[model samples]
Target: MISVEEAKRLILENTHVLDPVEVNLEESLGLVLAEDITSPLDLPAFTNSAMDGYALRSYDTEGAHEGFPAFLRIMGIIKAGDTANYELKNGEAIKVMTGAPVPPGADAVVMVEHTEVQEETLVVKKEIKPGENIRYKGEEIRRGDVALLKGTVITPASIGFLTELNVKRVRVYRKPKISLVVTGEELLAPDEEPKPGKIRDTNSVTLKFALSREPTEVISVDRVRDRKSAIEEKVERALRESDVVVVTGGVSTGDYDYVREVLESLGVRSIFWKVLQKPGGPLFFGRKDLTTVFGLPGNPASTLVCFYEYVLPSIRIMLGKNNKFPVEVDALVSEEIRKKADNKTHFLRGYIQGDGKHLHVKLAGPQGSHMLRSFALSNCLIVVPPDVTYLAPGSPVKVHLLPEVFL
Candidate 1:
């Protein structure tokens, strides 16, 4: 078996970023941009008013105060989206609303709260500074400026900004297509009643939910019994149609385990068979041409752990994401943890709590390969290296936050 770092390195070395595709701006959220986005036009394209006020020359309101206000003749009203044809003259003011274009020859604006109008006469109660309450053209972004760089992830604010710039489409890396194959003979559907010696199938449901969190397309999800022929047929078809294929179960050496043998028979070259880690030691990774495959353990917790550590990174790399690993943080352990020092890494489900100054973590519950209760209640996976046989309370440990918790 190889180390966890080695396994991850192999997976990334084999993966390649997908080609760029032009998609509509409405459909580009959560996608990484493949090209730099340049502003097509200036933001706010024109000099406009920043508040509901009267636009006039600064000299017209000089020495004005509440005790002795300066009076000027009202020209006309300029609302937002309306073109101003009349220019302001000396001792003249125009009633301008927020976002309205400032009339020509106007050097300042006085807010309406500071003045009162009487018939056609305008009252200015405060001294107005030049260029006050005016949003200058291109103040935020100028034409031909690089608004967003390549490899930037699109967010809601990005969409609004692009809309203002009239960008109809964006070039982004294409999302990868994936397929899932679940194998087990003593498994029943989730809604079906469990009979004697049979349990409900939770891997398919959990894997589907986990895959939904990534920007990937799951084309198909197939369930097969512990039969070599059935497994071979599904694997071959999935390899031909998908960029990545994840098969949960039949990976370990058992009387009925057939995933490894079937994968080899279909000409899949195995990069690695196992990793030095608990909960998912019997993981399998291989490739055939451009398609990658992962054979995860049958246990529910093991399947999820393998997916989070290995499969998720591969998908992110293909999607052109710079950070392909889960978010990691260092926290102090709340209790002592002991293990057998078997030269294997252990991922324990734990809960993290922050006390303003420091972050403290504790085990959620039992750390069993088959149990999902603890995994569901936990927000992070406490990573313990092979050399660590025991950890005392208050010891620092690396923690990988779950996708739902961090994303």
Candidate 2:
């Protein structure tokens, strides 16, 4: 078994970023940009009014106040999207709505709330300065300006910004295609009633849901009986079709465990077989050509933990994301925890509580490998290193916030 850090390093060293693909702007959300996005045209496109106000020369409203206001003739009304071809002369104002183009020769805008319209006569109650309440062309983003840098993750705001810049398509790292193979003879489908010796198959659904949180394409999810031939056939097909293949069960040493053997038979060189970690020690990582395979433990909690620690990072690296690991934060433990000084890292399900000033993390419930209820209730994983045997209450610990917690 290798250390967790060593296992992570090996996985990253072997993984390569996927090639960039030109996708429609609507399909780029949650994807990392492979190229810098430059603006094709200026944002706003023209000088427009920022508020529903009257556009006029600043000199026309000089020294104007509620006590003694300046009155000017209203030229015409200009609403948003209307062509403002009219020009303002001295003592003339244009009633312009928000986002409407300001008429020529109008250097300032006075909000309608500060003035009143009386029978086509514009009342400027407040003194207006030059360029007031006007959104100028290219003020936010000029043409040819780099609106977004490479490696930036696309968000909803990014979509709107790109659309504003007239970017119809974006170059982004292609999302990795993944396939899942769950191997266990004692596992029953969720819809089927469980027998005395069989249990419901939670790994398939749980793993699929977890994978959905990432920018990945889960092409297929196959459930196979615990037989060498069946496992081999499914593994071979998954490896052939997917960029990443995640197989749950049949990895640990048992009478029916045959995933490791099957992978080796298919020429998948094992980078590592296990990690020095709690809940998920019997993890397997290997690579064959351009495809990477991860054999996770059959236990639901262990499968999810290994996915977050190992598989998720590999997928992110392929997507060209800079931060491949889960978001980590420092928190104080709410209760003391004791365990043997076994040289293995422990990931305990935790719920974080805030007291307005500090963050305190407490165990969600039982820390069993097969337990799914605690994992479901948890928002973070309290990381404990191998060297530490006891943690007193209020001890600082590094906590990894789960993916769904942010969602």
Question: Each model's C-alpha lDDT?
Answer: 0.93, 0.93
Which residue pairs in candidate 1 collide?
none
Q: Please count the clashing residue pairs in each candidate, in the order shown.
A: 0, 0
Against the true structure, what is every candidate's RMSD?
2.0, 1.3
Query: Model 1 misses residue 379 by how many Å?
Result: 1.3
Q: After superposition, how far is residue 191 of candidate 1 from its true place, in Å?
A: 2.0
lDDT of 1 at 266: 95
lDDT by residue for model 1 (240-331), tens: 99999999999999999999999999999999999999989999999999998999999998999999999999989988999898889999
TM-score of each: 0.93, 0.97
TM-score of 2: 0.97
Q: Which residues of candidate 2, in runs, are more than 4 Å off?
A: none
